[model samples]
Target: MPAAGSSLGKEVASSGDDLSKRLDRLEELVRSIAGDLRDVKQQQQGLGVAVLRLENRPKSPADNNAEVSANGVGATAEVA
Candidate 1:
């Protein structure tokens, strides 16, 4: 009947609106997560640079002596 068809049409329209709203919310969440991932990647790059600098820095004689003692090798040798 006409009344039944009208009710079904209204239901379909309401469902479509609900789906659109949910899709909008999903898009916002995806954007926020992408921004967060970019920040984390930048921080990781900074840490990598700092680690590389430390690794390339020269070691003092005392540091060398300590490392030698820890490894139980050349413990008696003078560092000069």
Candidate 2:
């Protein structure tokens, strides 16, 4: 017959192993989320830079004429 204390010891060791495995999985999930957040922030920063470049770009002839018209001023359209 097995000793009573041996069964209890086995159960305690099994529970500890299960707890360790769950903790490892939780740590992996946290690392994955942190990586994803870094990627999103990088993409967001690129998008902002693109928007700034567009906003600071030189205006074309058509854009200039449009702005003049929007201000209720008469603009002569140049024949290209």
Candidate 3:
């Protein structure tokens, strides 16, 4: 039969191994998340540029008059 101290030591060693593996898996997950975050930042930068370009574009008269015009006709025919 094994001594009580030796049995305790085996249990502690097995628990330590389990903890080490879990830590390694967590580290991998963290690295993957960091990469995803970098991609999101890059996409956000592109979207910001697109939004700025749209904002700087000239406004069309049609866009300005989405509602019925003062002449009581569809705005496009009135413009013509």
Candidate 4:
């Protein structure tokens, strides 16, 4: 029969190896999550710039006329 001390030592060594493998897997997952976060941040910045450009763009001719009428600009008198 194997000594009790030898069996306990083997169990401890096996547990240590399992723990090391789990830590390595956790590190890989963290790296993957960090990369995904960076991609999302970059895409968000691009979307912000696109929204700003749209907001600052010139209005179409019909839209301009509607705005002018709404603001009572360039009104003319009607002939009887």
Candidate 5:
């Protein structure tokens, strides 16, 4: 029932709204990825701190035995 010009105008407006919605969704996804990266960075820092502490601690005889095993050479394996 609408005039041809008005119908064309309505289609353009609808397409603009769809584009706006898609852009908003893309922005939301980018923000989510940034937040996830922050979380991963924090976890990596925490792990680094824990590893440093372990490395600085004095090693007991039990730890020495485990360290040898950690190098992939089991107690039963011959060493050069």
Candidate 6:
């Protein structure tokens, strides 16, 4: 019975060690993922700012020309 008890203790200790190692690996994985998410969030913010700038920018020369040509005065000016 003493030998059986010693074997049971060894098994318990082995399982506990395995559980600790797994927990450590899980913690490391979570930390790595969290870092990646932070980087992605920063990139997304930069993209958002760029999008906003594009949305609010002034029209190009082509757009201006189109607008002017839409009016009759622009064509008359070109002839003169």
Highest lDDT: give the candidate number.
Answer: 1
Q: Please give the distance, in angstroms, between residue 9's alpha carbon in candidate 3 and its true position after superposition.
A: 0.9
Off by over 4 Å in 5: 65-80
lDDT, candidate 2, equals 0.95
lDDT of 6 at 14: 100
**Ordering by lDDT:** 1, 4, 2, 5, 6, 3
Error of 4 at 18 (Å): 0.6
lDDT of 1 by residue, 1-80 (tens): 99999999999999999999999999999999999999999999999999999999999999998998999997576788
Pairs of residues clashing in candidate 3:
none
* TM-scores, each model vs. reference: 0.83, 0.77, 0.67, 0.72, 0.74, 0.74
Instruction: Candidate 1: give the clashing pairs.
Output: none
Whose TM-score is higher: candidate 2's or candidate 5's?
2
**lDDT digits (tens) for residues 5-43 of candidate 2:** 899899999999999999999999999999999999999
lDDT values for all models: 0.96, 0.95, 0.89, 0.96, 0.94, 0.94
Tell me how candidate 5 scores on lDDT.
0.94
lDDT tens readout by residue for model 3, 1-80: 57998999999999999999999999999999999999999999999999999999998888666544765566444453
Q: Relative to the unseen true structure, what is the C-alpha lDDT of residue 58 in candidate 6, on a scale of 0 to 100?
A: 96
Worst 10-residue lDDT window, candidate 6: 71-80
* Model 4 C-alpha lDDT per residue in residues 11-79, reported as the tens digit of each score: 999999999999999999999999999999999999999999998999889988998899999888899
Q: List the candidate numbers ranked by TM-score, top first.
A: 1, 2, 6, 5, 4, 3
Window of ten residues with lowest summed lDDT in model 4: 1-10
What is the lDDT for 8 in model 1?
100
lDDT of 2 at 29: 100
